[model samples]
Target chain A: MEKEISDPTLTVSGQRGPASHERRIQIIKSAHEHFLQYGYKKTSVADLAKAIGVSSAYIYRFFESKQAIGEAICSVVLGKFVVALHELASSDMSASNRLRKLYITLLDMSLEMFFNERKLHDITIAAVEERWCTTTQYHQTKYEVITKIIQDGRASGEFERKTPLDEVVMAIVETLYPFSHPILLQHPILLEQSEPEVLHQRAIAVSNLVLRSLAP
Target chain B: MEKEISDPTLTVSGQRGPASHERRIQIIKSAHEHFLQYGYKKTSVADLAKAIGVSSAYIYRFFESKQAIGEAICSVVLGKFVVALHELASSDMSASNRLRKLYITLLDMSLEMFFNERKLHDITIAAVEERWCTTTQYHQTKYEVITKIIQDGRASGEFERKTPLDEVVMAIVETLYPFSHPILLQHPILLEQSEPEVLHQRAIAVSNLVLRSLAP
Candidate 1:
């Protein structure tokens, strides 16, 4: 799906200048801080405007809604995550080893957001529940990186070539849902069981299972 | 973990009369109706007592808290689900076929709850998020049924016996998380995409992959 970023000020017909770009960044920064402190659902667009010393109408020129600002914040966070995944996928490691690291990296990154950046984590949960474009777009990019890794693995005779590519990809993503998906990760039962050491062991075990299924 | 059912009236030392048993059933039924109408979180024990024309202290004799009443309601629902699973697991079908059926059944049942019994579905989601005993106990029973199916497959020489039984069981459960887990299923994005036909096709694909991995 196309990202729903309908900033009228940045449109081709409107053609806003560099100051508008700077203002957009400032709005996002202030919103991010307020959301982290008061929670995404609790903080209002009017509150964001007041904190930034601007009118609500002025903030509206840059982003359409509160969720739109949320999407902007999510893009920054999820985009960096996708970039890190791309780097790991293209690194000079065996396909099997790289796959293992990718799975572990996903768990570690989400865990970090949960424990260290908790309020931001709530925003992420909202992004997912509300189906924000940033969340969908991020998944799209992450899937491409995974596809590349799988194709590379097959080309190098590291994985079986018989199963259709999409099925394999879906299976892998579903299998890793407990670790990778934000809602599943925040599950109180899963949270209780997620000692760092215990999670490491389970991630390795799950990784090994995926590798076994992919073995040529 | 053991189920946290603390009904003081039901213990051997305090064996209540048959009237007490009837009162307990009445309490659960009234609570279930109110929970379905208003929601588990919204309904208070005092309201329940008022509805049933009993004192709050009398209600406490049967259940420790509001969550305990929620658990009793969940047990009735989830217990029926487990019984159905057990029947399916022992049915006269090939192990591979039975496993596929089990996966599809899980998806169908959860989707049924999501679409048809939406208010009750909210309670289930709360049960999972709160780590209610009913949810954990249900998962434990479901896992055992899955384990039994895998064991039968291995005994019949239909599945590879080399993978440790526990590892194979864990792998299968994790792979089926999207279909079976309440939190994952309630995700709005997933719900949007979960037309029955699409879900059926994906479940089949995932089951096929697992069966291929289990082949000797």
Candidate 2:
């Protein structure tokens, strides 16, 4: 509740005719920046509004609470991840290669945020636990991406068709839990290797296990 | 808290020579029953002593708090799961068969708890989130069982050595997460089938995916 930040109009003074939707995006971005800087539990709505040079009341028009902002941040991050997986899945690489790359990317992104970007990772974990609508959509889309890859793999005669495609895709993600799951990754027994190379090797091994499990 | 329940001598009136440790075991069993009969959050220390015909103070002599009793109950349940896994892992069945049976048992037990024993399922979830020490130990022991099975799989020429055996074991558990995880079992997408037979088929499908992944 900074006195100086109480004026949303003044904050937008430099712009000639900023639309309400554009301002909402600006608010979301500013809140996301605050999250990355201050961590999830510590970042207050007032802090986010002050950082954006807007009044807390002004920010309230856009978001209901800090939890809303946090969900938006996670949606953005996970959206980007799903987009990356879709891109790789749609590429010209062999279906098997695409699936492997998809998991490698997944493992890398999750681990990077977890180990290097601790604040952001904590926020993401909170969002996940809350199971926001966006998180559900992200999982749904992720399932489709894996499903598409399996469909392609089946068409190419690369993967065995012994199980239903949906089940196989689900099993692949579920089995690779140790390599990509952030919470499970935190367990000392699953994560003795701190070196990125060692961990990457583990991810690769896991990806290979998935690939081989589906081989024709 | 009841005056008469605190009378330890009266609680064990007929016992000529009761060891303190043995009494502790009896207290754990009584608390476990109360937990099953009345969910963890509702089951109080006084209620436990009342059920056991002992004083609340006497219950404290054998246990620290209600949380400790809850944890002990979880420990006993998870210990049984680990033992079941170990027995299958050590049996004369082929390592592939053993692994498949292991996951089948896991999925069945988890789903059974979720669907048939709602109170116990809630208690399990609480203990999991609480990260009880025994839960940690259970995970450690479960990992060993998977590792042993993987080793036997390799020895039996059923699995290849593409990944470190440790990583492979972790991958198998991670990948089969949906079929075996209680929380995931509650998801509509994963548990569309209410019939145990249908769910068992899904577990088998997942188990085969893992088995195929490790095939030479």
Candidate 3:
């Protein structure tokens, strides 16, 4: 189900007392870890507050609820993805080369997120499934960042002009999203004997298909 | 978590007594529904047992545990996928026409499975992630079916001799796999407002790319 965050008005840039901002960041980071470890259903707001050494009220003071905390976590991760793609687009590499790099980088980031922060990944999957905080400005901003990269590539004749940039971005996003969610990637029977190399090879093969499609 | 089924020996063939076989099929169907409704973690063996009007032990009598049930569920779904692909391959159509039909059929089948059999899709994602049942007889059977199609197309001079059939099959499977998993496609903030037409267009575009790569 899509989690609903009550305080859609909250912003990372909103004016706050220095101490309050610091505490909020602490709570968010702690909550991220807790959510990653126990998942959204199992990790309570109180658990996050306790982990951050703050009162539940303090957490509320910064955010509204567990769902709000989840939005923040997803925003942080997706924000990272956008920023990296933007950097790749701006680099001196050719459009096709840059796109390939972006694909590989995105895959690596997803794998890292899956292995390192499984709880947050789980929370993100829940958020995505439930359509939680999807209408929020934060998500729109991230989408724009991705769209801009494709637009830039097209404008510079780096990508095929006929291809729909927005659709390509969405497909790539959909393709890479599962690898970030450990719960989606963990196959019990396959895990018994499948080496990491095998999984990595599969990721590379998928990336190649996406990259091939995006090439000019 | 890797769901461990107790007796990995009970195959899905209508082998156990007729009553037992019918009961097993019913349990799998109920379990599939539960998986779709609550996901893998939230759907317990007890929940499945209750839904199927059987005791947990009765459920276990046919399969071993929740994980074993998951394996059976995925095997059933994937088995269907392989069968569909084989049918497409064996049809008396031109190679290019067969490829096109194969793409469209797979896409429709996958989307149907994703939306209708949510539980089976969830179990498959878990199976893929955990690397469980990777080298299973089912996958081998699937590979052979796909390879046969490519080999037939190649011998008929319908596809480029340089095209790697194994790689192409892998690409098709991997690309479609992500879309079949709801957790990847159902991002609330990122995809909640996303139009289905956009997704359809993206699928068509990617299929075209795959086809172009195989063209002689």
Highest-scoring model, lDDT:
1
Compared with the true structure, what per-residue lDDT tens digits does model 3 show for residues B1-216? 111222223244322334448777788777777787788877888888887788988876776678877877666776676667566666788766766566567557766775576555556656655545622544554455556666767888876676455667776666654444344453333333555566566666556665545656
Q: For residues A1-216, could you state the per-residue lDDT of candidate 2 as single tens digits?
A: 001111111111111223448888888787777777887888788888888898998877767788877776666677666677667767888888988787678878877667666667667656556556666666666677788788888888988877777778766656555556555554333344346677676667668777878888
| C-alpha root-mean-square deviation, each candidate | 5.5, 11.1, 7.8
User: For chain B alone, what TM-score does every candidate structure achieve against the true structure?
Assistant: 0.85, 0.79, 0.71
The global Cα lDDT (0 to 1) of model 1 is 0.76
Per-residue lDDT for A135-198 in model 1, tens only?
Answer: 7766766677678778889988999999999988877766677787888886546777668776
Comparing 1 with 3 on TM-score, the higher-scoring candidate is 1
The residue-by-residue lDDT of candidate 3 on A57-106, one tens digit each, is: 87777676677777776767766765665566567775556655654675
lDDT of candidate 1 over B102-143, digit per residue (tens): 889889887887776667876787787777767666777677
Local distance difference test, each candidate: 0.76, 0.67, 0.60
TM-score of each: 0.87, 0.67, 0.70
Candidate 3 chain A least-lDDT 10 residues: A1-10
**Model 2 chain A: ten consecutive residues of lowest lDDT:** A1-10
Preferred candidate (TM-score higher): 2 or 3: 3
lDDT for predicted candidate 2 compared with the true structure: 0.67
TM-score of chain A of 2: 0.80
